[model samples]
Structures are given as C-alpha cells and as structure tokens.
Target: MFGSQPNGLSTDNKMLSFQMASDKVKGILQLKKYLEQFGYLNYKNSKNRTHENDDDFDESLESAIKTYQLNFHVNSTGVLDKKTLSKMAMPRCGVADIVNGTNCMRSGKKNHHHRHGSGSPFHTVSHYTFIPGNPRWPASQTHLTYSFLPRTRSDAINPVDKAFQTWQGNTHFRFTRVQDSSNSNIKIGFGRGDHGDGRRNAFDGPGGTIAHAFPPPDGRFHYDADEQWAVGATPNSFDLETVALHEIGHLLGLEHSEVEGYHVSLHLYWSH
Candidate 1:
C-alpha cells in the first residue's frame, strides 16, 4: 500500500505508499479511494472491481494511475509510490485531466508562434497549444467585455479582475468590466453543480475541482462556489487568481500544456 518516508514524516503522509509486496490492505484501499475521486479508476472501466468494492490493485487501476502521473508530470511508474500518493493529497483544481473530445470547436489552422528548441521531444520544453482547431476570439476586436454575474462574491471580484490583468499584461487582449449589460462577451460567475454550460464536466463540490472556463467564443468562466477560494495562497485554500489565470488561458484559446520532453517547434491551428 504505502511506505513510511525517512526523517519522521507523519503517519498520514506514509498512509498510501505502503509497499504492494507487503500488502498493506488498508493503505491500498485508501489509494483506490483517492484515485476514484479524481475520475481515474471508476466502476465501469476497472475489470475486477468498482470504487465501492475494489481491493486488489488490478491492471485497470494501474493504467489510470499512470495517466494521472503523466498528466501531473510525476514519474509514470504505474505504482502507488510515495511521490504519487503525496501529489494526490495536494489540493488542486477539479477540472478533469482528460476533457471530453467533443467539447471543443476546431478551425484546423496553425499559428506561427516562435519555436524554442529542436529535435528531441524529451529535451524540449512544452509550450501551451490551443484545442484542436485552435479556436480563438477575434484578434481584430482588441477590447473584450466581461462582467461578474449576480451572486458573485464582492471580495472575489478584485482577485478575478487581477486574474484578467495577468492575461492583459502578456497578451494583446484587453478586458473591461461592464454592469447591467447583457451584451458582454465574457460572463464570469460562481456556480455549484451544473451551471448550464451544456457539458458533462460539472463542478464536483468543494475539493475535486477549483474552476473551469470555456474556450473562445463561448467565454463562460465558472468557479466552484463550494470551494474555499482565496485571493491569495492560504493553507487549505486555493489561490483564486492563480486558478483564474489558468482558466482565462482557456478563454484565450490555450489548452493544457502537454508536450512531454523538449522540442523547438510552434504550431497553431484554427478557423475564423
């Protein structure tokens, strides 16, 4: 299951890394539970067990665990090792690592961003890429409008604005807030459960996800109201601005950075 680390780390920290050969049954069970919460090992896909009845570390669980490791940049050992367990315990956004394939709009065009390296993918640093089609807002329209929907906490507004500022500082896109205006291009809000994005990726309450934003043209950004979101980093609380900055990247047609290793090549694909 889980193994104890040297230097006297707490028992809680050692709970999931229990060695499989040693068969720490309880620790292995805990590992299964953690993976399930993140949508890695679910009932339908696992061959031997469902989340409710899983006990043995089966192949299905192993594959999902490896995927989790790769997505988080952990060594893809496919075992419930200490580092993997420790990372699982960290509080992070609830956005699914593997988003639904149909949930995107593509233009099939490429952008000519500068390339940084050449040859080896492992040695090359990965930069952000857009969703397949490279969908983006109109570049000619420099000023994009935004506003918080009603029920957005007053204190949350400043951090959210600052998140936009982070984007504005780097990109040509400029965001301005509007009040009582139905025509704003970007709508920001906090929602619990399904806020009607017409997608399966709904918020999963407090801990699983922090926030998610739609890609350009959709312009719907949502933070899970159930989470302990803070303007700045706080113990046990998510930095609202940091999460907002990542989501806004989505708003600007960027997807999760997934290039493994290093390469000096830039590609952009989208349609107007």
Candidate 2:
C-alpha cells in the first residue's frame, strides 16, 4: 500500500519512540511464513476436530490446544497465558533468536497507501515465464524493459534487479529485462512514485516495504527511492530478494493466504 502520504521524519520519530514486547519477537519468529501467507493474525476454532491423543509429541499438544480454544469459542492466544498454559498439552520453551532484524513495518499504519485484501483466486499453476541473463542488460528476456531513472541511485537499481532475478531463479516463470520501449510486455522503472500491475498504487510506507511485481503476462516491478540498498556484503538491509520472491508469487496467480476454514480443510483433505 505505497500511495499513502509520505509523512517523513516526524512519523519515523513517533515510531522510534514506541517499544515492542519480547513476546512479539517470539510470535514473529514462529509466525513469519504463516503471516506472509495469511497476512494477519486471525485464529479461530476448529470444528469436527479430532485430538491427536499423543501426549508425548509437542505438535500434538499444540493441536490439542488449538482444539480446546476452538471448542470453547476463545481466542487461541497461542501464547502460554495463565489460562492456556494449564490446558497446553506440552510445554515449550520461548525462542531465543527473536527480533534480530528490523522491526516488521505495517502496510497502512502511516500514510503509505498500498492496501491488500483477498486477492483473485489462484490458478492451479502459475503462468509467467522467465528469460535468462541480468535484467539490467537489454538482451536478457522478452517480456521486460529496463531503464535507469535519474531520480533513483545505482544502489537502488542493483538490489531491485537482484530481487527480480531471485524470483526468476526460484520459480518457473519466463521473464526478461529489455531497454525502454513501449512494445515491451513488462517494464521496470525506478523512482519515488508508484508503479505495478494491481490498481493499488505501488510505492508506499518506509524503505523496508521494498519492491513489488505486477501480476504476470505484464509482470512489471518497481523499487522504492527512500531505502539505502546494499548489494553484496550485507545482502541488502531490506532483503529485496525476499520481497521480490513474495511479489513474484503474487504475479504468478497466488493470492494472500485465506483463513483455514471448511474450504481449506477440504482442499487439504481431498485435493492432491
């Protein structure tokens, strides 16, 4: 959600003043990928649930806790609060390696405008294709057109390029970077403003929100101007590669993770 207002340093000062709890770190660590899938913390009760009945296994215990909370219509806080602790089938230790990197920034908290709701239904398989070579070079791929925007620095250029490359390497998609031409299928532009496939404005929030890709066939992507991108040694502070990986997942017909409901259970139990 990048189109929201750019409040600048006053917003940063306000954010810096707030303190987050240690528990949040553990929650983040445990739920990182889950959050990426579902986009938020929303846990509800499970119906037609069966207990694993294995007291010895930690996962079984967790499932039991989930069942207990669901049946009772209480929030499955997941944390070992006083009420949950006694009912928790197996006790687990808190994670030590919590809160290592930057604080996770919310999408619309500031004036940043990019907002995501449930996306279109996912295809059984992704349709995008990938073309080889560095995207910065004109000879790379067929669908892409690349250009250096003077407003943005070279540092920004390199990381954003890396992010796109990383996505191509990891997924089965056909894409290529080309020189500026209106005929190109996908175009990459660098600047402070918004760009991408969705109707939502692309550029929003602080630097950490990084870059996003357009849905495929026209898989355009862009990077934010505010960030200080590090190419080689530090692996770039914001991990542009990871963000691109996620966005490319979007471009390839995947939607934000849906809540686990009867539909999901049916998919899990019946579908391949």
Candidate 3:
C-alpha cells in the first residue's frame, strides 16, 4: 500500500518527516510491523526505554537497515531519512504475486541459448569468454555466477553455499565468494558508508527486494543491507538459506517462472 504526503512538501524532506512521524504516531504502522515481522526489532531493548517514538538503532538494527537499502537500489547511507521512508512506503511485489500467472513472472517467447561467441539473454555465460583472469572456456561452454551478501552468522554461509553447489551439480561452471574490500576483488560493506542501508527506501515493501546478483564472468551479487538474516524459524520468519538460493538462480539466468508449466509444454512440442 502507498501513502501520501501533505501539499507544498519537498520530496527529499518527506521521507525523513514520515519516518519521524511513523516512529511517533501509529498512522503508518505497516513499516514497523514489517520490521518486527522480520525480527529486526528487539523487544527486550525497548522494554526499559520509555521513548517509543525514537529509533534506538544498535549494531544489529543498523545492519538490518543497511541490508534492506542495498537490495532496493537506494543509497546505503544507513540513515532512515525521508527519501528512504517514502520508498519504503511504496507497494512491493508480493511472493504470491510473483508465483504463477502474475505480471511479474511473464517472459517473452524468445529462447536464450548459450552458444559459443553468440550473445544471448544469458549474460553470465556470454561474459565468461572475456573474463581476464578466468581460464579459457572450451570451444563451446556456458558458465554462471552466484553472488550475494554474506550472512552475519558464519554458520549460515556453509550450508547455504553447499545447497547452491548441490543445485548446480554437473553444470559446467565455477563459483567464488566475493570477499570484503580487503580481498581486492569486490568488497561488500555491511552497514557503513556506501554499504549501509539507512536510506528511507530500504525494506519498504515485502522486505524491499531482499538481494540480487549479476550473471557470471561479471560475478557480482549484492544483498539488502537492512535485514536480520536468521538460520531457522524465528518470530520474524526470515529464511536466509531459501532467499540466497532464489537470488542465486537469478544470477544463473533463470527468471521467475509462471507455475512451471507454460514453458514445459513449449519445450516438449519443440523437442521434435
């Protein structure tokens, strides 16, 4: 659901003002409810504090905000100002809406093939031929890249990585982890400076487009800076492993499907 602002208001100032208002009044409670649903808010921390209108952002809360901003393509400033808040108020593409027969999942009739020297919708596979440090591909080969933000919990990465590896079994491709700036490849910052998700638009709707990745050879993926990724069931219901796998599929050139059947018939009919 989208919200409106008063007349004669500056677009930039509106998000910050709305956030302050949301923090104070219950008029725009959806955003706060969504955050609590995802387990970003710590009830214990607020127990003793009497100021309900103030955002007592801690390290974890800061992390959650940053993650959300990065995924939504907003500036990851880690400050919940007006711009970020207004973006958060926009409508999100719901999971059910993306399932099958939805506008979000529709694709054209074109078939994207990863042939040698041929450009296709599969950008990751095509870029492999030009990657400077990569070994030369076979005369005809296709490759994919899966990039994402690392979970704060070290334990979460291994299992999620293994799941992705298993999902790609027998495919002619390689996977690598993008480390922090210290490693020199491409650094991902969690909640500070360019990596922070404090912008007002972060996580506005449906957790604000959790994360995304570039196709292979390019090999760059990013996650929302404002999420509290959890391993298992929590009150907020964040599923780190599941979300990672979904985004990885996108990096691998798989678009969201429409109930998985529309294209199946086409494939079978064309097999002859």
Best by TM-score: 1
Expressed as tens digits, the lDDT of each residue in 89-207 for candidate 3 is 43221122121222223333323334332332223321111111222334354443333345444645674676457445524655555554334222222332234333432333234
- Which candidate leads the pack in lDDT? 1
In Å, residue 237's CA in model 3 sits off its true spot by 3.1
- Residue 77 displacement in candidate 3 (angstroms): 39
lDDT of 2 by residue, 89-171 (tens): 12111111011221111111112122223332222333221211112323334344444433545455565566557545443
**lDDT of every model, 2 decimals:** 0.59, 0.34, 0.38
Determine which window of 10 residues in candidate 3 has minimal summed lDDT: 263-272
lDDT, candidate 3, at 25: 27
lDDT of 2: 0.34
lDDT tens string, model 1, 199-250?
Answer: 4557656654457777789888888887776667576666666667667777
User: Model 1, residue 252: what's the lDDT?
Assistant: 82
- Candidate 3's C-alpha runs over 4 A off are 1-104, 108-153, 176-206, 260-272
RMSD to truth, every model = 8.6, 17.3, 16.0
